[model samples]
Target: MLTHFERSLVEALRPLPDHRLTAIVEVARLSPPERREVFDKFGNAGYPILYQEHFANLRDIGPWLFCSGKYTSLQGQYNFHHGLSKATGDTPISWLTSALEPSRLARHLGEAATASGPDGSTHLLRFYNEQAFPILHSRQDLPGIDHLLVPIHSWWLRDAELDRDDGEKGWRRYEGKDRADCCGVPPIHLDQACWDALTGDGSSQRLADLLGSLPGAPAIESYYPNWLAQVRSLLAKGRRLGLKQQADLDEFVLFLSLHANPLRGSAKLEAAFNAAFKDAVDGNQPLAQALKQRLPPRLLTSQSNV
Candidate 1:
């Protein structure tokens, strides 16, 4: 269950203000210790502080702070895979355990090397089934998250091609140029294009549909589905309280994080709640106040109405 500190953090997050919520993005851009300090106050005894950033707009890069201390190695092993599994689906192709398998990396390394781009950066082409592919986005260290050392990778760049738009007639233009001059090239800002190809303007619902079919495939854990379901259920409840978007998960989690302590509500749900909120509630004072107001009054459940 949740220790006192985790419980405290949750309370602080429950009634998040929009201004403070935006402040979260700013705080996320802070120094590691400073950022973690925000969540350190709310986590239960075991609660770990964590920050996550998306790369190639495809994967969530996390610098997680759990009780034992930060471990970049574990994060590296899970980085791209974790984000994809959560956003897409957890299947054998995107399986966490499978990715961690030493053999998997060894087998893929040769292919990873051959696929290097002109910039000397190698592409990680993950083959799921036979027709789909994944690619790497970019590399940068985000401190407020984990002291993470993992590079972000995405799965959709395998088929991406850039077509040069009509070039302005000039010395820079090579000879006679028409739209034909436009040909296959990948953008330096691969992340944005990958995002559009996957979730935005030219987004493929077919891909989303494919990912949906993968949840219970071989090697996928039974619990993940239940976990996701529970998250959606709580999220739906939070929507009734005015949380309607993906960001609402933060406010909902903040609420639970506050009452997560024994002093506020059910230890079971509080424990469960802390697992979900983690780094999202950065122990800011506004969050602390919100919990004081939004937490439900503690009551015994006798199934009294029934």
Candidate 2:
């Protein structure tokens, strides 16, 4: 089934009469048959953005570029974009219009498949992955990354974390700046700024501040000297369970604070709370409000426990 981003991508990629057409399809997560269909339709001439030079044998699983000429009608849209994003939990194929030939474009992108890290370590940069692309785009002065798409006439990428023009929560777009001729790779490295955006490098300091800022941070006050780590562990669990918002995360911190190490101190209560948490997130209701049935009223209102 088509996702919410599929139509928006198709509409956005529809180029002007003079514009070019090409898109990146991630085939690694796709089933074997799905991968075959793409190759069969496009042939072996398709360019891969990630390559063996940087990715080694795993390059086969990377994204492929194809000319999407017949993307006018809905069926044509299906033909060009059709099921291209079938791979589960992967970013959708991104669109780019470049005046350069396919080979030159491929060469330019392949250069970015790898990056150097501090202490002389080399790491693969998933530059083409729209999911990670936002991280790279979030900051300025990111070595080669800031202008990686300079050669392309126009580049459009999708990010699921952002708000869309439509009322619904779906995809967001980031257009490339510095549209100049490709000047080869600029030694894209895991710089300090890039690392922070990529991995939340200074998260401990931020989390500590958050713990102090919100009264609901820890379900209980800590006698433990390593309270930050304890709260960190609690927040980690909450994140895995879909608690992304600051308020929801703080409330979850408060809830799990009382649950103890085994979580709720019993399997049965844990199960009950799990169901309630899921319901609250899915229904867009306040988490603490929903937990009223699952948790005792006195406990919810009590002072932070030690």
Candidate 3:
């Protein structure tokens, strides 16, 4: 029953890990009726196999999600922008129908009633029997699929914005509006820089350039000591922060240690930080002294202060 493309996709996905392959298989096996059930319930309007391919490709190569243009509708509009905005809202009566029906609603209402305490039982039962069950029973069966595909929508890519012309026509459309009067400022509306970076031609190449520059440009070695110095300076000034701030700083340090150095793991970084703090507190040395002792000497020596 598989088409050539579908067969090829399955072959391609076969070599992936068991979990990924299972996901692909589950998506691909969705019968037409099953897919229709999903569309009717969720307003998602894509072939399951297409979504499966998108997911598989995204897993293998990170940027495939953006490049696939699966986000684009048949009309060339962004699917989320055009399609999702047009989706009908569920009626209030549908809620009650779903509650009384032998569907996801009954389970949900039961959970809500339990969470609400003894007084909620009557109200919840009334809502379910009168509202949810009838609407749910009237509809066809829902999909058994584990995951739902939700498209990312943006206003910048809306048909109106993309169709804009320059000069005379554009000026006439804007007439009395100043730069401040508009929702967005200046010539190209929206965050032009970020928009171009995301949706522009050769977006994949731009992403590649970004990834390639990460390791060499910032020079992680240089960044680590400066971060440590800021923490040391704060400690030296006897300025205490709230628990959340302290936890955030601790997490930031762990992130820097894990990512900045290819050889280090969370456990190694944790040990280093633990040893440094122990030395600082027990020996009456400054936090900076403990850092210098535990961290790479080259990084500390080059930084001069902390």
Candidate 4:
């Protein structure tokens, strides 16, 4: 069944001029037959975001933009948008609408396919993924991001998952405005902020997944944003106090949440958390042991049982 979001989006784009609206889709999501129809057999139907000259190996699975006119046959807007939900498993989508010639828009995204981290590590950046694009669209930590957004008058993405937020999820339409011009080459550079939001030592989705999968972790259905924010906040606090190892950080987030936020609680638990952070970092004591040692068993038991 077509989702309310997809139906509404098709209506929104059906009136646009030829080449003005494009469906940003990942090739990996396309079935073999779908790939052949949209790409190999249908010339001018879509343009890939990864250039063959630079990313021949990745081109097959990279993101591609399917223009409206030829593929849809209904004016110049996409009528074939249902394929999107099929490919992305009905998750939110990233859309591109621009007056800049289709090829130019495709080239800009092709150039943005990779990124350079602040620490000097370089890797392919999937800037077009539905989950990642919303974060990319809002973050201004990198110049390359500006370059990518320059030609786009409107960028469409969603911040929340499809099933939970308001019926159609959180549809965010961003206008590219303010600050430096969007220019430059491939491999966008990233600072700490971008890295943290994008992939901070597996501290983004990976960390959330780790915690959310635990036997006692709260279900994300009703409190996705709160749960993520709480997890990140606790992880940051732990880092400040000296926790570094993955295991320690994970434990710290859990321990803090179990205490219903250690830093925000009574001065007693705060003191225990401080000692626990220090213990996890330098001393051989595990965070749980250190915290339990400092606090009474009744206190620990009450909170953990909650």
Clashes of each: 24, 0, 10, 1
Global lDDT scores for all candidate models: 0.26, 0.57, 0.26, 0.61
TM-score of each: 0.17, 0.54, 0.22, 0.58
List model 2 lDDT by residue over 216-288, tens digit each.
4433233121334334544545554566555565567666654545554678767767877887678667676
For 173-289, candidate 4 gives per-residue lDDT tens digits of 677642123443545886665566556445655656655665755576654553464455455555545666766776666665555544576887777767766777896776667
lDDT of 1 at 68: 12
- Over the stretch 56-115, how does candidate 3's per-residue lDDT look in tens digits? 553221111111122222222223222222332211111000101122212222222211
Write one digit per residue (lDDT tens) for candidate 1, span 193-253: 2323212231133222322344343232432332232233344334333333344343453
Ranking by TM-score: 4, 2, 3, 1
- On lDDT, the leading prediction is 4
Best by TM-score: 4
Off by over 4 Å in 2: 1-15, 52-56, 69-79, 83-91, 153-158, 161-169, 178-180, 200-306
Model 4: lowest-lDDT 10 consecutive positions = 177-186
Off by over 4 Å in 3: 1-259, 262-270, 277-287, 301-306
Candidate with more favorable, higher lDDT: 1 or 2 = 2
* Regions of candidate 1 where Cα sits further than 4 Å from its true position: 1-220, 244-248, 254-289, 292-306
